[model samples]
Target: MTLNRPDVFGSISLMFWSIVIVVCIKYLGFITRADNDGEGGILALAHLTRSSLREGSRRYALVMILGVIGASLFYGDSLLTPSISVLSAVEGIEVAIPSLSHVVLELGVLIIVGLFVVQRHGTEKVGKSFGPIMIVWFVTLAAMGLTHIAEDPSILAALSPHYGMLFIAEHPFIAFVASGAIVLVITGTEALYADMGHLGRPAIATAWFGLVFPALTLNYLGQGAMILNHPETVSNPFFKMAPDWGQIPLVLLSTMATVIASQAVISGVYSVSRQAERLGYLPRLTVRQTSAHTGGQIYVPAVNWLVFAGVLALMLTFGESSRLATAYGVAVTATFILTTVLFCVYASSALGWKPWQVLLAGGLFGVIELAFFAANVTKVFHGGWLPILVALLLSTVMLTWQRGVVLVTARRTKLEGPLTEYLSSDAVVNVKRIPGSAVFLHPSKQTVPLALRENVHFNQVLHNNVVIVTTRSLNVPHVDDSERVTIDHLASEYDRITHVQLDYGFSDHQDVPAGLKVAAERHGVELDIENATYFISRITLRISDRPGMARWRKGIVRGLAQNAARPSDYFHLPIDRTVLMGAEVNF
Candidate 1:
């Protein structure tokens, strides 16, 4: 009854079966309404839905909400998983050598710190070796569990639906609480999808079903056997399954596996943050390119440091994995439910399903997920607040960044206008004597920006030819240089204004000046980057005593904004060409 890969008669047959199993598992992981097992999990899904919405599609709102919830849960899960996985492994040290119990927590903290420190070096160099190491880890777990299963075949009974269900039904309250702990077993499954694009669906599926899943199942069953035989050891059953001689090695191996799991979650946060920036939910940050070829391979220093600090704080506060479990399950469960809702919307819009059909399927899944969410919610008083607080803090930053962009865009739209107005004005009478044409590059769709009024009044002399360039995004993946720019004459003297819009794909970087140059030449205008002055309105946030968001969340948003890198750097505009107009506003 051990959940091992079925034996094939020959190599050809084995290959055939492997493909079949991997393909099936891949689809299961993809369509199960769960987050992508690879780097594209709930957060990636949220970005997709948000981008779709921004493109004038309102149908995906519900789906986006669900995705947000699911991603938020994952954040919570991130906080908890490291604690549990690392702590559980450390506890093994205590079981192996009882005298080491006093130092177990300290050792676990040190290990967690070391793991965080190495993250600056991209995972790619070390990750290539992860698969092979994990294979060994899985095999060891399976082999160890198999030894116990041989002694009592009945250990397989734990796999039955009845056991889990009955355990819940009889001790409803404790089971509800314990479910938070039990869910940790499958906590990393979603990582399979989040990291899907990196490992590829086929490889992850092969790794999971072929090795990880069976090993995990066997280990759980073996642990169950130990609990049944020596009920006294139920407090920590996993370690009890190991023999006296093998305990130390098992502890070492388990710690390694947990470290790998933590690494995956940390990396996932980095990937999601980058995606968020592209989709406009996050502010422009310093993104260090990790790999020349892989666009997705990036390092955000702030995020890395933040997560490291949080993980350290978690290790210090919780001190044990069990307490951290309460916080972990709630966030992950919430994320799962959110993803289901988003998937339903995607199925209807993208897949062209009928509304009722989407609702029916979504509703069914939602009920099951909500139940799990509710079960986790009951643990709020225990220690669930930690992950929620983290997610709330993150969500505030995301929302604030989004709001700031919108406000800036709105203010720009109000200030700029067609070049013809300046040409007709008597104030530009002196411009005829000026040497060269003045080009103002404003980041907006409107010909005039609100903040430009003061600049216009101060610089009364208008250029013989004025160009107001603005960039626009298209739904298509890319716009050729020839099609990137467009020009329209405004109704003012010899003054003329041009709007330049650049259509960049989500996968592409935004290069404003380069795009502007290409666009101007394509539209029959002479390219002059040197003559162009980039007018960027820098919004200085004022925190009013008037109530807005919760005090803590508002503080988080301000901190995030304060740390946000300037947009000029993000768009690769030269500092010499930039003009900073500062204005304070309340959110």
Candidate 2:
């Protein structure tokens, strides 16, 4: 930013106003109110809005696309944030010990690597210390900034709307450019909403207003005051604010805080990926529950490694935090803009807001976010293109996986026909019955299980008791254990066939065997837990080079299906008792 030599007053004004408008108002005021059950985030909000709309409607598809795009943008932010935050903090070594500056990049990369490696073990152990560390960190920031504020008391005047308006009015172009950097102050504001399910709105609000908001304000103000006294220090005012002795400790503290900060986003990436799989926008990956007591405590090795690789590439290519800064605001602002648009959809579809009311709220928020987005647009040519490219690639992958599921499901349904029609057919009634129970996992109870049909087609012997289990993920956060799972006695014919439908919210943990046990107990079915063989149809997708998608897309979609984790592991089934039936599908 010093390269541009923009006015300090304009930059400072824009910075404070951004925190107030974007963080304090736009998110807290409107966005967080539209959570899906107790969960809140762009993906959760997308599910909430879609839940209100009729299935197969245009609005539902539109909301799903926007949700997927918002999630992809989050992936971009997750990659860029850790690199920039850690690098920026490590650069403070130059302030504490000028001679040690040469090792800053190496140290930054090392710290980031350590951060990623510990991710698989999960945050359960160190997470207890995070609260205390951040509390001390924020208090230190406030104390540091409060002492410096006495140096130039006038810096407080930037808080007024007048200064912000005047700065924008007098220097429109510079204020526009300043907004791109000012956005750095509010980078993690979305976390407030994303984590609402974990902490709840009341706790998040209490922490934000009672501690975070004040601490951040004081620290940024102190930096402004220090820069006011010595304008030459504008290059890195944050580190320059501390005295010689305090600089080293501050640098160490900053590094720790940045690591903690990066951990939050990495955890967010894991959560969004889980939701994507649950909603069928992605293939089921290996989800290891890091905490046995906490259902949401999950870690994905694939997502972790991919994110680390992306972060490393970003650090190496950008070389400095300043260059990476140009890439930051684009993804954050784009996500914010989309969230605002999605909220408007929710306000109308769910809340039944009038047109004027929606316009007054959403239009105001949209125009502000659009301005921030436009300011960020000026940076695309200046190394800001990375996140955009990342987002595009992710969006393509998500769309491909989603489209592939539809095609595969359609093909299967057409081949097997409905469950009712098939069960009532002459062949099922007279087929030779074998011993032991066979449980088949299917997507829908109304559709015939491909594994069952194929099993009977080849072997020509049906199990004496064949149980078809269809698991569904709903749009809310959790499902009560008692309401949904049931064994369809009437649907069962020849006293050997039964249908079990298990329903869960997207955020719920799914255990097929456990659910079946409950269903079996309630229905008075004599079930042997270990003796039952769980069957799953393993699909090998081929490139049909269909009309809807290009040949390359078809190949990519096929690769995703072929590489996905096996259904047994994904669903937490007993490995020894599971049987997978393979089939080829060219679509």
Candidate 3:
């Protein structure tokens, strides 16, 4: 009966599966990295934590602590993964020619430098070429694996539920540890979800299930076959599977792919940093335009230089892929687990699903993720300290920036009276009339910012029309221009306002004044950008011995603020029309 069955079914099934693999491969990596401000990675996860939970809620505090911790660990993963991915591929060269080992490290460094230098060109041009190159890479992997699979048909047995189950049963601890190593195969898979807004969910899902999964599975199985067939070659099964002549091209391709992975992460850092600044967790940094079309395609000079330095340090110190592997999984796995938890919360609150329903559905996924996380944690005593150290340093900086901004804002607000009080007071009423509308730019929603109060005491004169401009961001990117800016009347003469924020996906520049003008016109306000005066309060922070945070943290906070970009420039306020009220404030 089996022999009489048509071969057409098998042919059609193979064709269907092939299509699925191709689609998955195209978008899997990109999807895993998408997040706020057109960036994805640990920092994006941190932003998610702050944005999702209420400040006063117990869940907010808990999620914040957990998110930061997870984000810090993700930094570790970012540092180590490049080294592993590149070195493992380069090491394949050693199989073809043993003498290349002495020079491989130098080659690796060259590849990393070249990768970062080209980032200014924007990923769109390079990314277009990536799909084709990845196609070749996957095809090569599949071909190599197929050749070996022919030798021992039983090697396919590993795909069976029984082999995996039996392997775990026999050596649970070893299997757990091995799972960490294997998980590297799907390292950037989450980018598929994070980048959903960029590539769209259907594209990413199709890419993973179709092309990427099959190619990766084939390559991994080929490596497994090499290990099983020649037990002595277990030291580096990937290299053993490659033919002598194919090793050089494989090495080059692998190095290229690793560089691509690092580029994704570094770009992610820039996006997340900008988002954090907007969310009030980070100080604004000078974000330089890298591309004209993509608002998300920005180059943060400070972050870029810092990441380049860190990558170099990591390459120099680790020197080998095996050693770097120790640090790879811990951070990213932790982030994955944290994301699941956050997603559960988001599903419940934002999606308006039943709490029990979300908990049940998300909880299953969480359990599997945590198991993987635990495996990564087991690797901590090894060279994992590398990523942990990097993450801790980053988290410290993030937390300090957040705390310092809060304290400084609070101190500034203390000096100002309520809007109703200020408008009714003799001080505002007695002021000389000015020609145009006077807009006061305050940092918070409270009565008066301390910097504004200092400026008011010195200037003493109020303008004819008073407008307090406050900018707000929605969780999603790219709001309609009509909804971008909203003006609400708070009291008789007092106005409360908000803005609809728009960000182009990671490849365009943001023009705040132009955007505001467009939005205002759409909302029926004749905004005269040419004649309007923009007022900004510049706070100069003074270091004090007042007890608040650790001395080191205080120093870090001061340095971050000092190095931050001036608000006028960051917000794209017109230099020709803007005036700064500089005042010294204590934190």
Measured by TM-score, the strongest candidate is 2
Pairs of colliding residues, candidate 2 = none
Alpha-carbon deviation at 75 in model 3, angstroms: 1.7
Q: What tens digits encode model 1's per-residue C-alpha lDDT throughout 1-587?
A: 12121110121122222222222332344453333323467666665555445455565454554555465556666666776788888888878888989998899889888887777676675576566777778888888788877876776655544555554455577555555544554456555556554445566666667776677767766655555556677676666677888888888988998889887887667767666776677776677655534444556787778777777788888888777765666777677666666666556555667988887767765664566678778888888887788777666566666665665455444444444464456654443334443445455543454334445566644444455666664434356666666666554313454545566643446788787677566665544666766766666665555454555555655666777887788777778867776656564
Model 1 earns a TM-score of: 0.76
Candidate lDDT (C-alpha), each: 0.62, 0.81, 0.61
- Window of ten residues with lowest summed lDDT in model 1: 3-12
Q: Count steric clashes of candidate 3.
A: 34
TM-score of each: 0.76, 0.92, 0.79
lDDT winner, 1 or 3: 1
TM-score winner between candidates 1 and 3: 3
Query: Which structure among the candidates has the greatest lDDT?
Result: 2
lDDT of 3 at 207: 65
Per-residue accuracy of model 2 over 36-93 as CA lDDT, tens digit each? 6566678888999999999999999999899999989889999998999999999999
User: What's the candidate order when arranged by decreasing TM-score?
Assistant: 2, 3, 1
Per-model RMSD to reference: 6.9, 3.0, 6.9
Model 1 residue 382 lDDT?
A: 82
